[model samples]
Target: MENKNIEVKDENGNDDLYEHFRFLADKGQQPLRVDKYLMNRVENATRNKIQKAAKDGNIHINDVAVKSSYKVKPHDVITVLFEHPPYELLLTPENLPIDIVYEDDDVLVVNKEPGMVVHPGHGNYSGTLINALAYHFENLPNPAIINGVNNTNRPGLVHRIDKDTSGLLVVAKTDIAMTHLAKQFFNKTTEREYVALVWGAMEETEGTIEGHIGRHPKNRLQNTVYLNEDDLHKGKPAVTHYKILEKLGYVTLVSCRLETGRTHQIRVHMKHIGHTLFNDARYGGDAILKGTTFTKYKQFVDNCFKILPRQALHARTLGFIHPTTNEFMKFESPIPKDIQQCIEKWQKYSTHAEQ
Candidate 1:
């Protein structure tokens, strides 16, 4: 059997648990029901899981949605998508406080704080937004049921943000709401703008960063942009439009709009152009990349790091069509206190240095 494994990054551009799989039947294969075929071929897969996937329109044959009973002929192409990792974790609700921006029967908007994991994953199995959501929305809608099987592990979560990135996120309260919001995100109809403080002043006041983003071949924990045309297909297209809002002496605060939400799009693109986000530990912005070689300046930089220990990124604005009412909705979040203080400290330091 011909097989291919693909890593499907979460649409929110941070989570890395979702996975997609594709298979091509061997030329000598006999006709078989698609769900039955998948159960036999996919390790740890059950008929109920396959049926649910088919019911949710997640199972496709030759790029078209198919039913569980659809016959898979020789050389037929098959594919399936999982919202979370294959390894199931016992989801337990915790009484964690979340900043609820707006809530309705169909959807809710949250102002996710810095250092909060959006969902439970590899190293984080608790104290996540999912756990908090589970606590709050205990009876949230479940996925499609087929043969008495339903995956209710992740309820109400439609998108996510990075743990260190503070921002606005929307959650769906029902399956229909989830599907509607998911389609909007997939079609790139949602509008998201982030405010970031980068290590250096930008040469241009406004510009667009265009590149294909993919996993770093050497470092599994990092993502890089592919500049070579031949290697473009190895990654996915990503675009970030940025405008400098303020140019501090050592760092610049900028507004970024995302056209395509590839993983780490803003962070990687800005780093590629030599303006990594301030205090972004993973992209090497935690160090003093730009500044004078003065003891006072070094001390000032250290103080700023203490003020905002994580990457200086905030999802300031989000816009999308309402899942239930079909009306366009938009939400804005102010920069967190830590980042605000960091900016104030830099402003004070810059003024002192000029004097």
Candidate 2:
């Protein structure tokens, strides 16, 4: 058999949960499905996650990316990659303040403040939520433990919100809890709601934005929605249901419920529909998207932007079934001061415009 060499990368800078695994197939090895081979070698790994990695082109043989059904041959060098890295080198605990919303033996819910990264990556190696968790707790659970390859468990992040988005996040403390919570997220049974102050009034009070989302080709920092038949396959299916909560003339406050939790789903979907989240610089919402170009109007909008320098999006509500108890649990977080001030400013401006 000819050896195939393929290079795979997650160029979106989503390296927070990245895990790398490698194995050398024995000379006596028989042809076997790559998924099963990995399951046996990678301890504590879930079959679902293994197949998902394969589907994402993260499974490679002899440096060649392969599918889940690829047959493993003798003397082949197999490698698998994943988003969830083991807790070790990056577990530098920091004595930062963490707002604990709820915690029990099995899980811990945190209302992560905006501007705090969920985990360390790139240049941010400390002052992250994981760092805070490490300081508060001993060893958390990492669901994917590949025996000798990354056999460490730390705080398990079932789902993560953006660094600039303030919201509730649940961390699993046990293997069973991590598995259960991850399944819920994968099955799309978990409820996630965000409140966003977007540019312009929405034409529809309630609607669903259905599109495929993937990393933008030109702008690596942003994700774009694919609605056309030809381009749809380039991205993954993502659905977002939204409703206008308040129409503030220039900018409308809306609530978005995600059916599929794609990266930057809300930001991309809202921008696709011509209502980008207010002050979201990456998606071109930082400048004045709505309102008159008068100097005073520009200053007012600029002041609002200054008030909420980051994206005007907040993860307000989260609901899911408890991994251990099987009881439905819900969490709500208040809009932080910056967002609140921005909204109030918009409320007053809209009222004045109406008058």
Off by over 4 Å in 2: 1-88, 145-154
Residue-by-residue lDDT tens digits, candidate 1, 51-78: 9999987787887779999988867878
Number of clashing pairs per prediction, in order: 0, 2
Give the TM-scores of the predictions, in the order they appear: 0.75, 0.76
TM-score for predicted model 2 compared with the true structure: 0.76
lDDT of each: 0.81, 0.81
| lDDT score, candidate 2 | 0.81
| Distance from true location, Cα of 201 in model 2, Å | 1.1
Per-residue lDDT for 73-126 in model 2, tens only? 978888876555533454687899999999999999999999998875545667
